[model samples]
Target: MLHMTCKGKIHRARVTEANLDYVGSISIDEQLMEAASIRPFEMVQINGLRSAQTWQTYTIPAPYGSGEICVNGPPAHLFRVGDLVIILSVGFFTESDLERFQHRTVLVDEQNHLVDVKTYTRQSAHHIRGGEGK
Candidate 1:
């Protein structure tokens, strides 16, 4: 059996732009993508902190170190610049894979700058604690 598990997360990333004209998808900083091990076109779940809205979208890499987090297409209307959002990507894993599975969480500052990158194994999920962003 395969279980869906979180592969990576970008926590507390602020929206830098919202482009209603674009086709669709979220643009993330290349650095952030690398830190979280998120690949371009990978499906992600975005949760808005203030609005409490959740949506699914794919990721596109912005310039390296650009600190960009843009919402595009119709979803752009649901977000705004400066909104704090959590982006998560998930993948399917078999029982054996879960034994060694580790997920990456990339924490960011208010300005969407990388603060830290944390790795969590299934065993550590309940024990680890941090700021609200995580």
Candidate 2:
């Protein structure tokens, strides 16, 4: 059987832009995307901590080290600049795959710069070495 599980998360990233005129999708810094194991055009679910809003969207890579987190299209009206939000990507995993599955966590500072990275299992968590746009 396959179980839906979280694959990666970018925690507490401060929103830096909102372009309501754009088509759709969230623009994330390349560095942040890599750290969180999120691929370009991958679907992600975002929770706006301040507005208590949840929305689904795909990702677009911004310039590396740009500290960019832009909400485009309709979501722009819900999640605005300076709002802290959580971005998550999920996948379906088999029971065996869950044994060694480690969810990638990318923690960013207020400016959206990478602060640390972690890997977590159902059992425990470990801090991995951090690099790129730190």
Clashes (backbone N, CA, C under 3 Å), per candidate, total 0, 0
Task: Please give, for residues 19-108, the per-residue lDDT of candidate 1 as tens digits.
Answer: 999999999999999999899999999999889999999999999988999999988889999998989989999999999999998988
lDDT of each: 0.91, 0.91
Best model number under TM-score:
1
Clash pairs for candidate 1: none
Which 10 consecutive positions of candidate 2 have the poorest summed lDDT?
125-134
Instruction: Please write out the lDDT profile of model 2 over residues 1-134, one tens digit for every residue.
Output: 99999899998999999999999999999999999989999999999889999999999999998999999999999998899999999889999999989898898988999998877786764333353224
CA error at residue 59 for candidate 1, angstroms: 0.9
